[model samples]
Target chain A: MRNYQEILDTLIDVSKHPLRQVKEFKARTGHKAIGCFPEYVPSELVYAAGMFPVGLWGGSVENSRAKEYVPAFCCYVLMSDLEYGLNGTYKDIDAVIIPSLCDTLKCLGQNFKVAVPSIKHIQFTYPQMRKIEAGVTFLESEYGRVLAALEEICGTKVTDKAISEAINVFNDNRRALRRFVGLASEHTDVITPVIRHAVIKSGFFMEKPQHTALVNELCDALSALPVSKKGKRVLLTGIMADDDAMLNILTDNGLAIAVDDLAQETRQFRYDVPSEGGSAMHRLAMWWQIFEGCSLAYDPEKKRIDMILEDVDKYDAKGVIVCMMKFCDPEEYDYPLLKDALEKKGVPCLYMEIDQKAEAQAQTRIQAFSEIL
Target chain B: MYTIGIDIGSTACKAVALKDGKEIVGSSIIQTGTGTSGPGRVYEDVFKAAGLMPEGVSRIVVTGYGRLTFEKADNQISELSCHAKGVHFLMPQARTIIDIGGQDAKALKLSPAGTLTGFVMNDKCAAGTGRFLDVMAKILEVDVGELAELSSRSTERISISNVCTVFAESEVISQLAAGKKREDIAAGIHMSVANRVAGLARRVGIEPDVVLTGGVAQNLGVIRAMSEILEMNILPAPMPQLTGALGAAIFAYDEAIKLK
Candidate 1:
C-alpha cells in the first residue's frame, strides 16, 4: 500500500495524466462545484454547504489569447478568466462568485457575466472600510445571504453544526499547511519538489477524506525531515501573486517565501470561536477583525510595518518583496508609506510590479532584487 | 455666433465663450459648486454673473471632474483626451501636453497633426501633482496659486526629494528645519513635479512646444521649471483650465454638425 506522502506525490506529478486524474475525480464525486477568486472566498463555508470549493487561479500566462480581450491596464483577474473560459478549462464550473474588492474587480465581474452566458455568477460588493462595528454587521448579513443562496443552489442544509465541523476540518488542514510551509522554510530534503506539489494540490483541491490524508502525510513527512540551511525568509505583500511566478523568481534568487500575507490566504480566515457562547457574533466579529487585521486590505501602513516585522522575525526573514500588480492603485498608494516604515525599522523591502504577461523585465528585476536582498 | 466652454474644477469654474471658435467673447471665473452644491447650481450663478442668457450660447461643452454632473453638456470627453485636444488647438505646433489637476496629472504626447500618440497619468499618488503643491503651500501660509509666480522668481531651484506625499510633507518640515528659503523650496517642489512629468514624456519621447494646461498651468513658476527640465518652450493656452471644456465643446460642435 502506498504511503499518504506517496499518494500526494502521485497526485502532484500531473504531467502524465492530469486531465485523466481530474476527470476521474469528477466522475466519482457527485459534489456541487463553486468557483471563487482569492479574496473573500470562504472555502470552509462552501464545504459546510456540501459543495466542492475550487480556488480559481484565473489562467496561465502561456495562453496569449487573453491579451487580445482585455486592455494592458485592466486587472489580471479579468484576463485570466477570459483565457480560462475561452480555453474551455472552466466548462465544469457551476457558479462563480466575485467580490467587489476594487473598481477593476467590480467591472471585471460585470463584463465576465456578459461574456460567459452559461455560468451563474454573483458579485459581492464588500465594504471598503472594515474596522467599525457597523461594517462587521453588514458583512455578517452578506455572508448569511450568500450561504442561503449557496444552500438553495446545492440543495443541502448548512446548519451551524455543519459549519463548525467544516471549520474544524479547515483548522486541521491549516495546521498541516503550516507544517508544509515550515518545512519549505527549513529547506528539508524529504519534502521534495514532487511532495510539495502534491501538498499544494491536495491542500487546495481535496474536500475531506483526501484532504485529511494528504495533510497527515505532509505533516508526517515534514516531521521526519531534517532542517536545511537558514536562508532569507521572505513574506510576500500586495496582490494575489501566484500567477506572476514570484515564488520561482524569488527562490531562484536565494529568497524563500516563508509565508504570504495575501488578502486571499491568511487574511480571510479568522479564528472561529463559537458564535453563541459569549457575544453570539464572536465568529463574525473575528471575521471582520481578520479583514482589518490584514495589511493588504487597506492603507494601514503601520499595520503593514508591524506585520512585516512580525513575519520577518518569526520566519527569520532578511527582507520583504512587495509584489505589486500593475494598475493596482491601492497598493501603489500604500507602497511608499510601507517603504518608509520598513526603511526606518531597518528592514529592506523591494517593490516590483507585474501583470499577467510576465516578461524579461520581471526576470531581470528579480535577479537584481535578490542580489540586493 | 459663439461657442462656450465651462471647466468646473475642484475649487472654481472657468467659463470661456469664443466667437467663431477663435475670438473670446466673454470669459468668467467663479468659485465652483457653491459650498458642496452641484455644478448645475454654480453654472446658473456663473451665467448670471456674466449677464448671459442660457439660449445665447450656440453650443456648450463641459469638462473637468464635474463635467459628467452637468446636464446641459453636448458632449463629455475624458480629461486626458480633452487636454491634449485643447493644447493641440491652441499650439498647433505643440507635440507634448502636460495637464496637472487637483487630484491627478497627465502627460500627453500628440502627433504633429494633433492626434494623440501616447500618454502617462499620475492617478495613484498625490505626489508630483497639484495636490502636493496645495498642501505644501498651505503649510507655507500662502495661496497655492501664488507659488507658481513666487517660485519662478527664485534664483535657483532647490531639491525637495521624497516621492511619497506623507514623506514629502516631512521633507518640507525638514527643509524648514534646515532653514532653507521658502521660495527656493517652493521652486524646488515645482521642479520635482516637472521632473516627473518630463520623465513620463521622455519615455514616449518629448517633442518641442510642450503645452501646459489644467489649473496648474496658471503657475508660471512650474511652467518655467518644466521648460528648464525639458529644455523646450512651455506654452500656456489662454484660459488653460478650461481646455478640457473647450475640447469637449469642439467635439460637441462637430457631433451636432454631423447630425445635421
Candidate 2:
C-alpha cells in the first residue's frame, strides 16, 4: 500500500515544478472564458452554456490593484474584481457574473461597469427569501436573463433537452465529488493528486462534459483505494481559501483538510431545486431557491455560522479554520462570535486574515497553526 | 509661527492655521471630488484654498479617515488624539468630544492636559454619520447643505426611528406620504442622528464640556438635538474638521523639534 505522506510529498513536488509551458499552451487557444466571482457561481450552467468557467482568484496582496477601486474597508472583494478589471489578467473572459451577496460586490459591480467597459456584465439581483413564490420568480427571471446572455455570446441556444442532459452529467460529477469528499473523511491512504488538482483546475480549464468525465473517473479510482493513517481532520470556514500556495503549505504540514466549507463550491452544489413541471422560467427560479441555501446568494450570517458548526461536527473535524480576507466587514463581524462559540464548545479555532495574494507569510502562519492542532 | 493641521476626511477636507495656539485661519468644506476622488485629492483642495505650499507649512499634522492615505504629512495622529487636541484648543474646559464624520461617528474623553482618557467609535455603519443626513435630505428633495437651517425652523417634533439609511430613506418617504411637514421630518432626522451619537457617547459615558467636531459639527440642528439629548451644552471649534489635521501637524512639529 502506498503511504499517504509519500503521495502528498510527490504531489507537492509536482506543484512546485515549473508549469509555464503548460499554462502558455492553454492560453494559446484564446479560450472563450466566463469568470465567476465567488461562492455559488453555478459552474454547471457556465459549462452547459459552452464557455470555460474560470474562478477569478484576483492577484497578490503587495501593491494591490483592488485598493484603487474599492475602499480600504473591502479588501477581498475588491482584489478579486481588480484582478480581472485593473490588472487585465482575465482579459480572455468575454463576460462575468457578480452575485449580490453583500455590499462589497454590489459596489464592485456598480463601479466596474464604468471602470472596465469591454466585458459583458450581469449581476444576479438576489430576492428576499421570506416569500417563496416571489423569490423563485425573481431567481427564474435572473437565470433566464443570464441564459439569454450566454446564448448570444456563445452563439449556441440551450434547448430544454440539452439542459436536462447537462444537469445529469453535472449531477454525476457531483456524486463523484461527494464520493471523493467521503473518501477524504474515511482517512484515505492515497488520494489521486491528479484528480484533486484536475477537479479544481476543471473550474478553469475544460468545458462541463470533459471535466465531469475526468473528475468522475478520478473519484471512482480513489474510492477503490485502501485506508491510510487518519490524521486530524479540519473544516475550513469563510471565503474560499484563495491562497493555493497556502493550501499546499498546510497539506505539507500534516494538516489534512478533509472538508472545507468554501463559499464557492458549497454554495454551488449544496442545493438542487429542480425546475418543476411549471414553465422553464419557474424551474430556473426553483434552482435558485435551492442554491440560495449557500450564503453567497444571501446574507446568511447567523445561519452560516451555525451551519459551519454543524459541518464541523458532521465531518468530525478536530478544529476549525476561519480564513478571512482583509477588509471584509461581514465576515469580520461574524468571525469573532463564531470563534468564541467554537472555542466554548472545546473546538480549537484559528482565524487568519489573508490579502488577495497568498504569500509565504500565509503559508508560515497556516503551518504554525496546523502544528498547534 | 503657525502650526497648521489638515484632516482629509471621507467627505470633506479641513484646514486650520494656528499662531501661538490661537486660530488665525480655518475652513471646513465639501471635498471637490463630489464622491469619487481619493482622500489625498481632497487635502490638495484644502491646501489650495488655504494658499499654503506644502514646504512652507510648519509643524504639519494630519488626522481622520484618510490620514494614513495622504503621505505628504509631517506626522500622522489618530482621530481620537486630534479630537482631544482640537477640543482642548477650542474650549480648555472640554472633557468630552463627539464627532460625526462621513461614515463613522466617535465620542471621546479627554484628561485636563488634553490627554486622551478613553473613547468609543462607531466605525461599522453609516447610521449616525453625515451621510445619513445627506440621504435624508435627498429624500426631502433639499440640498444637504441647507439641512441644518431647515431642521432648526421646525416647531413640531416628529420621530424618524429606522437606523439603517436604506430603511430610513424609505421611512422618510412614507412620512412624506402621510402628509408630515418636511421640516418636522428633517428635525426628526436630526434627532435620530443625535440619538445615535448620544448612544455612542453613553457607551464611554458622556463627560462635561463636550466638544463636537467633524463635518457634521457644521450642522446646527445636530448640535442642538445632541445637546438636548445629552442635556449638555455642546461646544464646536471654529474649524472642527481641521482638528485632526491640526493634531497631525502638532505631532509633526514635535518630531521636527525633537530631531533638531
Candidate 3:
C-alpha cells in the first residue's frame, strides 16, 4: 500500500502552492488552464475541450488594488479573486468561467473585465427554479455557451463523447473523495483538520483522474489501519472553511470535523451527474437539479437544515460549526433557520465568521464549544 | 486542597483561589491583559492575597482570550463554560447568561441543571462590548463608571443608530455638537449596547432567570437598558469580573478531585 502520509504531504503541497501546481500541470500537459469560480461552475466542459480546469476560490493575498474594483464589503473570496487577477497571480489562465450564484458573484463577473482585462471572462447564470423542465434546459444552454467559449479559447470542438467521459472521471473522483471523508472521520488522529482540508482542496488544482487515484490510495491505506477511538466530532456548514489558522484552532481544541457541508469542500461532490440523462450537457445540468442542502441552491423548503441534522446524527457529531464566510449573504440568510432547527433538535451550533484577511481569534470559541460538547 | 483559576481577558486579568473547590480563599483583578504583564501580575497578586505560595495550589485552570498564553495553567477552559459554571453557583436559577467582555459580547443558554445548551457571540465587533463603552466614555470626557449615573439623569431619549463603533463615536460627537445633553447621549450609548447584546440573547432564545456577567455587567445603566429591552429581570453576578476566574477555579477543583 502507498504511504498515506506521503500522499497527504503531496496533496497538501499542491493545496498550499496552487500556482506552482498550475504551472506544473501546464508544463506537463501542454494545455491551457481555464479558471472556474466558486459555488458551481462545471469543470467537465473545460476537461472535455482538451484544456485544464482550475478552481479560483481566491487566496490569502492582500487587497489594495481589488478594493478599487469591488466594494470593501464584498465577500473576501471574491475580493481575493479580483486581487489575484489584478496582481497577475492568475495571468496564466487563458479564460475564466464565472457563475452568477449570488449578488456579489454577479458583481464580480462584471468587475473582472475592468480589473483584470488580460484574461477572457465567460459568465453564466444558474437557473434558480432548477427542478422545472425549462430550468434544466436553460442551465444546459448556459453550460453550452460556456463550452462554446472554451472551444473558441482552445480552438478545439468538444464532442459529446468527450463530455460523457469527463463526467465519468469527475464522478469517480467525487466517489473517492466521499469515501476519503468518511474514512478520515474514523481516523482523526491521522487526519487533522488541516490535512483533511488540504487533501480535498488539492483536487481543485489537480486533474480529476490523478486526484482520484491519490485519494483512493490514501483511502486504502487508511482502511488498512485499525479504527482508533473517535474524538469530539463536529459538522461544518457554510461557503468554505479554507483558512489554515482557523482550522488549526479546531485541532488545538481537539475538535475533529466529522463531516462538512461547505461549498468549497463536500458541496461540490455530494451528488454526481446521471449517466443515462438525455444528453451529456443535460445530465450535467440535471446534477444541479438533484443537488440539495446548499445555501446558494435556492431550496425554499430549507432542506439544508434537515440535511445538517441528519449528518450530525449519522456521524454522531457533538455540535455543528457554521463557518459563515464574511459578507456571504446566502450563507448569512441560512444561519438563523439552521440555528433554530439545530436548537430544536438539541444540537449545539457555533457561528464563526470567516475572513481571509483577518487574524484568527477562533481559539476561544472552539475551546468553549469543545467544553460544551 | 487549594485550587486556582485565572481568566486573562482582553483588557483585564482576573484570578480566583478556592479552598477545597468550595470556599473562596482569595481573588485578584488587574487592569491589563495579554501582550502585557497582566497574567503574571495577577497570578502573583492572587497568591499573595490568598496568603499561599504557588507550591500550595493543587491545580491551576485558566480561561478567557489569554488563557492559552498563561504558562502556569494546568488546563484552559472556554470562558463560556466557566461563566456558566460561575453564574450557576452564584444564581442557581439562571437559565440565560449575557456576558459583555472587553472585546466581545456573548449570550449563553443554560439548562435548569446549569449545563450550557446554546450560545451566540458578537462577531469581531466592539459595538456591543466594554471596549465600546470605554471609547464612548473617552469621547464624552467622563469616567466609564460615571455613565450609569449620567444616564440615570436623562430626561429625553437619544438614539445612537450606528452599529459600528467608529461610526457611532462620530455620531456621538455630532450629537454633542447639536447641543444634546451628555446624560441623554450616555443613555443612548447604554441602549445601543443593550440592543446589540439583546439581539445576541434572542438568538439563543433567551430563557428566564437571566443573569449578566463580565466587567460590563457592573454598569447599572447597561443592566437597566438590557432588562427593559429583554423584558426580563437581569441579575448581575455578585462579582461580575471574577465569574470566569471563579468558574476556572471550579474546573480546577473538579480536575484535582478526578486526579486524586
Candidate 4:
C-alpha cells in the first residue's frame, strides 16, 4: 500500500500538469475527453457516454488571440480559457461544455465556437432560481440537452444505468473528498495549502473512481496518525484559491486553511446527487437544488454568508480570506454583504483579489492578517 | 535591553531603537529602499546613531517590503501590525490609521484597546501612493517636498479626473499645455490622491480619533484635503514615517521578553 506522502505527490503532479494527465489517460484508456468549464458543468453525462471528463479551469497562459474575442475587463479564468482554446492548447479536447454561470462565461462559450472551430462547443445555462419545482424541471431538460450533445460527440447512446453508475462513482469521489478535507484540517503540517489544493484539484484531471480510491487511502493513512496541533486556521471563501503564489504566501504566514467555500474546491464536492429520487437526470437536477452557498447559485437570503460564519466558528478559524476573482461579477456582488455579515459577527476577514495576469502583491496584507490572528 | 526595528519600504528605509521597550533611544530614516542598499545602510546607521553595537541589541525586527530579504533581522512583522503598535504607543486613543506608502495606500481600523481589528489596501495601483505625487512633481518641474507649499498658494481648484497613474500623467501634461497654473494643478493632484486614499479608508469603516502615518502624511496639503474629504480631523503622527519602524522595535522587545 502506498503511503499518504506518495499519494499526495501523485495528486500534486496531476494538478500541475493536467494536460499531461488528459493525454496519458486518453492514450491509456482509448477514450475521448470532454472539457468542462468553471463553476459547474455536469461531467457525469460525459462519463456515462464513456468519455473522460476534463476540467478546463483557466490556466496560467498568456493572452493574445483571446483578446480579440473578450474585452480586457473579463475575468482572468474565462480570458485564459478562451486563450487556451484559441491557441489550440485544448486541441485534444473532443468537445467543450460551457455553462453560463455568469456573463463572461456566456461570451466565452460564444467565442469558443467562432475562434476554436476545430473543437465542438456545448453550452448550457444554469437556472438562477434553482430552489423551486420550475427550476428543477427546467434544469432536468437542460441536462437532457447536454446528455444529447455528449452522446452525439461520442456516437454512443447513454443508458440510464451508465449515468447511475457514473453518479455513484462521482458520489464516492465527493464522499472521499469530504473526508479528506476534514482529515486534512487535522494534519495541516503534512497537507499545506498547496498540497490541499493539489489533492482536490487533481480530481478534476483523473478518473473519478481512481481519484476516490487515492483520497480514501490517504485519509485512512492520516487517520492512523495523531491529529496535529492547530496552527493559525483560516477560512477561504471565493471563486477559487488555486494560485501557487497566493498559496505560498499563506504557507509562509503559517496559515492553514481549516475550510473553504471556494467554488473550484469544496463547492464542487459539498453536495451529492440523491441516490433514490426520480430519474438519473432528475437526480442531477436535484443536486443543483440542494447546492447552496455559491455566488452563481442565486439565494435571496444569501445563506453563503451564514454558512461561512458557521464554518469559521466550527473550524476555530482565526480569520477568513476572501480570494476575490478579478472582474468576477457574481463573486464581486456577494462580497460587500459577506463582509458586512462577517464583521457583525466579529470575525476578521481579509479580501485579496486573485488575478492570473497580475503580479503577486498579497504578501503584506496576508502577513498583517496573520499578525492580527 | 535595546531592541531595534527596521522598516524597508518601497522608497524609504526607516529604523528605530527602543530602550527596554518604553523609551526611544535612536531613529534614522534613509530616502532609498527595497531594490537598493537601503536596508544595509539603515541597519548600520541606526546602530551608529544609537551608540550601540549590533551585538548588544536584544532583538532586531524588520517590516515593510524589504523585511523578507533582510537577513540580519531576528524577526519580521507586517507594517500594519507595527504601525498599530507604534501608533498605540504614541497615541492610544487612535482608532483608525491611514498609511500611504510609495506604491500602496492602506486603511486600518483599531479596537479601543489598540489591537488591529480590520484593514483595507489599494490593489496594485500607484494613484493613491507617494509615487503618484513624485510623478506629478517631476512633470510640474518642482521638488516633491515643495508640492504642499505650491498647492497652498492656489487660488482655483482644478480637477484631475483620471485616477490611473499613466492616464493621469497624460491629463497633467494636457493641463500644462492648456496653460493651467501649476499651483492649481498641484492642488488638483493632492485632491485626487486624497480622494483615492479616502475611498480605501471608507472600505475599512474609519472610526474617530483617526491618525495618519506614512511618508505621505508629511505633506500638509494631503492632510488638509484628506481631512475635508473624510469629514473628520485627521491627526498626523509625530515623526509619521518612523511609526512602522517603531512598531517593529516594540515587537522585537516583546519577542525578547518572551525568550527571557
- Candidate 1 per-residue C-alpha lDDT over A1-373 given as tens digits, one digit per residue, 9 for 90 to 100: 3454565555465323333444555678766677776466556677887777776656444546655656667767557776776676777777777777777777777766777767777667555566666676776667777777788778876887787677667667666566666666676234433334345544455565566666667567655656774445567777655542555555555666666565544443334433444232236334544544453365444576576677778877767777677777766777767777666776656556656654433443454345345
Query: Poorest 10 consecutive residues of model 2 chain A by lDDT?
Result: A13-22
User: What is the alpha-carbon lDDT for the whole of candidate 3?
Assistant: 0.91
Ranking 1 against 4 by TM-score, winner: 4
DockQ of every predicted complex: 0.01, 0.02, 0.74, 0.82
Model 3 reaches an interface RMSD of 1.4
Which residue pairs does candidate 1 place in steric collision? none
List the candidate numbers ranked by TM-score, top first: 4, 3, 1, 2
As a whole number from 0 to 100, the lDDT of residue A32 in candidate 4 is 94
Q: Could you tell which candidate, 2 or 4, scores higher by DockQ?
A: 4
TM-score computed on alpha carbons, candidate 4: 0.98
Tens-digit per-residue lDDT, B131-150, candidate 4: 99999999999999999999
Which numbered prediction scores highest in lDDT against the true structure? 4
Write the residue-wise lDDT of candidate 2 on B114-158 in tens digits: 876555566346899988988888889999889989987898989
Q: Flag regions of model 3 displaced more than 4 Å.
A: A357-360
Question: Which model is ahead, 1 or 4, in terms of lDDT?
Answer: 4
Tell me the TM-score for chain B of model 4. 0.99
For residues A242-300, write the lDDT of model 4, one tens digit per residue.
78888988998989999999999999999999998878989988999999999999999
**Alpha-carbon TM-score of each model against the true structure:** 0.55, 0.52, 0.97, 0.98
lDDT of each: 0.65, 0.65, 0.91, 0.91
